[model samples]
Target chain A: MNTSRHTRIRSIAVLIVAALILEVTTAVQYYSTRSSVASVIMEMAQRDVSTINRVAEVKKIAENALHHAVPEVERLFAQGDRDSLYRVLQQIVREHPELVGVDFACKVGDDGKRDGYFTFRNEETGGIQDTIIGFDYTERSWYREGLKHNGFWTEPYMSRYYVILMSTFAYPVRNDKGEVVAILGADVPMHELSAMTVQLYENMNHSLVPVIGLQLLGLLLLGFIMFRSIRSVRRLSEVSAEKDLINKELDIANDIQTAMLPDSSQIHEFAGEVSGTQNVKDCIDIAGSQVPAKQVGGDFYDFFVRDGKLFFNIGDVCGKGIPAALVMSMTQAVFRSVASKENSPARILQDMNVIASQGNSTGMFSTIFVGVLDLATGRLQYSSGGHDRPFVISGGALRQLEFKPGFPIGIMENATYWDFETEIAPGDMVMLYTDGLTEAMNGEKNLFGQQRIVDAINASGAFETPKQLLDTMSQAVAGFVCGAEQSDDLTMLAILYKGNSAADFPQK
Target chain B: MQITKTVENDNLTLSLEGRLDTLTAPQLEAEVNGKLDGVKTLIFDFQNLAYVSSAGLRILFMAQKIMNKQGKMIVRNANADIKDIFTVTGFSNILTLE
Candidate 1:
């Protein structure tokens, strides 16, 4: 995969891994929190139940003791020993500090005089007290309950001193004839029950501390993981942006290299010569397309007039991309320099060959075709450096210009080039091309060869001007290729020698 | 067609007038290519030039290649329409301009 795609996949993998980790961690935390809370709540409930049970146990014990004392107090009351009753109440209060007080009451005479003296001890004050019990107590609920029932206990109540108290095991004292005469009672306080409930609340608070601490830790870890993942993603994006910027700069450099070569439209203006009449001569029309097998290719073409001679050249360097572009530019500059001093096409090529061989340390060479058209006689002189021969059309017949191959440019310093001359008639056409044209392949890998090119030229009708000939040739090549990618630079230069009397060409 | 050139400190400046196209490109090409020796920089001034066809583009390509080896080539003051053409054909990427 490309670097960017690989980086993207890696980033996504990291995120997914992080997400899965977070999800699993969160689930664990949630379950742990839930179970921990439940355990704490259950423990608190158990403590509450135990506290209630303990309080109940103590109350039961106090009730049993009070009941046991009540029967004894009844017997004492029947014997009419108030002093003994008071001593028994004092002993009970000393045995149980939780009991506040114990009291006894007997009915008074009708004249409101004391008929009986009842004694009790106030446990809260640690004092023994007695009172002549009044008949008015018969209407009280606790007294009435005790009279109706043989023994009874009362609900808890707040006593005069603001203590929570309950009267337990109240017994009715019987007279000598077996009639109920008075009630015996004992009181208990609830201080121990309140203390147990306070202890249960304290235990619940202690158990919650660890559970809350674990939950907070889980949250902090999740936040940290999320932050780290985001930072990594941001860093990856910045790296991708930097790579893209570098690629753009390389692309710009490549473009500058391509712009240096001769474009097709200007071939006619620069390729040939002008006559004494100041009329343009030897107009060459270049119609070619390029499809790089890679990012860039080495095909190039150039034209210029120097010292009254039209200098035109087509070359294909042996490499591609920036290197080939650089070499092609160098070749053009060398050709221009040599063309200025040399009037003969052969001498110019020889000079260029020497210069190129010296400069080309890479062992690279270029196939070149250099031609000079004489505007005076419509005579074209040409020399080739291991390049394709020209296809000439004359008298409605196609023929290849015969020549021996010379060494490609930059191969040898003293390589000799021979000049060959051809006379171009008014309607005659000369076509110079690179291998890209003949080697162009279709979907079936079939090449558009030289014969096909000749056939296309023969098929095109006679044109009034050189430009028309070029246009027809270009259309024919396009038709032959038919949507096929140009595998290399397809370069073609067609020169038509117009007679002196031909009508001026139409301007675009 | 007329092509005027001035050289100073290894920099060659060509001010183009009339049309730079298939019919007129030879005059400019000949004048520029003949004096390319010792030139380190080339600046094409298209301010007074009225038109350039594909033929003119080819000559400019040749000129740029020549300059690429020696120094740099710059095209200046291109009209809006020509600039649009350059951009569409991907020539804008290839040429150095100001």
Candidate 2:
């Protein structure tokens, strides 16, 4: 059993161990991916710049040919020599299949009229293509764009004259004063541009192989680690489920044990019935409370008015938990049976001792205090069975009541007990409690002694009724043991007396 | 809580150490549940025992009650504080201590 427990612990801890290892490796993988991708992108970017510069140098030669010819063409046109200009245009358009055509338009008059020039190469006949009349060339996108910049690369567009998607490079020719006089450029078909883009992508793909490889490797590693983690997740869940089962059982046991105790509402009902009568309400008031250290404890208390007199008992069994709880229940029943038949506190205790010791097979015992109050005379008859001495508050004095102690019940057979009596004067309060009160401990393990209890009573001002005394004292004990586990069961009872009539507190 | 046992023929001695409260009481209970079936003398060593809540006392009671029928049970090496608890709760009357 112990080995399996250890194995379960190891299985649960394995998840943390594996996760920590994976975390470090994955962190390394993450940084490697970033640096590798960055370097690859840097290399590709440099290659693309080199490729563009080379293509621009080649294309510039052809545009430069048009530029060099511009001055000559201008001189010839001024001389009205259209033939030499045509020769220059024809030489430029001669052999390059991609260079569809070359054109040069110049305004000769202030009316902005342009002398349009030409070249001929049809698509069906695949040499340099033909160009038609330049109609208002200023309105042309290439002309307007080139006028702004010396070298302007036009976007691929369908030319009205060529009737095909084409790209253009237009270079402006400037006079001595730097004013644009003419535009000279060539047309390239879209298919060649598409081809260059495809080649660039192919080169990028080759350089990117390592980056993509690392990414895929990281993904596979993550998948494998995730699978292992998922398997360990079940082990952790199994451990949690076992813990949950234990916790649920504890809650259910606590609930069942609490249900076994009589609810205060039932006690309140009896207490209420006995009150409301002017004489009983004025002459007597009784309250009792109990709190177990565990889900179930061995402390118990009961109070009732019998034969025009009040009788009460509070006891603590030797130990705690289920066994002591069972004995506690038995003690209550035995005390109730014995108390009903007997009026004297000593006789009631003696009777309970005999009955409790009946099956004395289990060596269990309880310290108890029993009391009988004579309502007419305001006298309280009481007995202690190895319990803590009771306390009384009268004439503004708080002290433990003096009494002879006897052996606790269930310890020995035919044990004799003695009863003691004290007067419950008007405004006097009587308090009966178990040792769990005085023996309450704090986090430092220091006991809350009987002197503290006496001080608590004196600290709280006059008790108007028994319940007030009980509540204040309970609160004091609770405050004394704050944040400390209740090491024992605590039970307390208090009785505050008034004179035999409601006349004590005069009605207006 | 740690429980170490030494067995010799009809005698068995268990050395108990640490707190024997509600949480650890069941362990001692399990060790005593018929582990002494054929043993004539069962002994408890409490030299290192720090505390025993009432729940722990219940288990001890059960072990004593069981041994009452078939063998002898005794506890030894209890510190003064533990002895005081036993005396106050009446366990000293029934349990043999040394």
Best by TM-score: 2
Tens digits of per-residue lDDT for model 2, A399-505: 67666676578866777788898888878888888767877888876777778988888898788877888889889988988979887888787877765664332
How well does chain A score by TM in each candidate? 0.51, 0.56
lDDT of 1 by residue, A392-416 (tens): 7776777887665566677667777
Estimate every model's Cα lDDT from 0 to 1: 0.67, 0.74
TM-score of 1: 0.45
Q: Show the colliding residue pairs in model 2.
A: A121-A128, A121-A129, A121-A130
Per-residue lDDT of model 1, residues B1-98, tens digit only: 67788889898899998666444766776876657988998999989876554446656766776787889999999887567445423346558978
- Share of reference contacts found in each model: 0.00, 0.10
Indicate the TM-score of model 2: 0.56
DockQ (C-alpha based) per candidate is 0.01, 0.13
Residue A263 lDDT in candidate 2: 42
lDDT of 1 at A99: 61
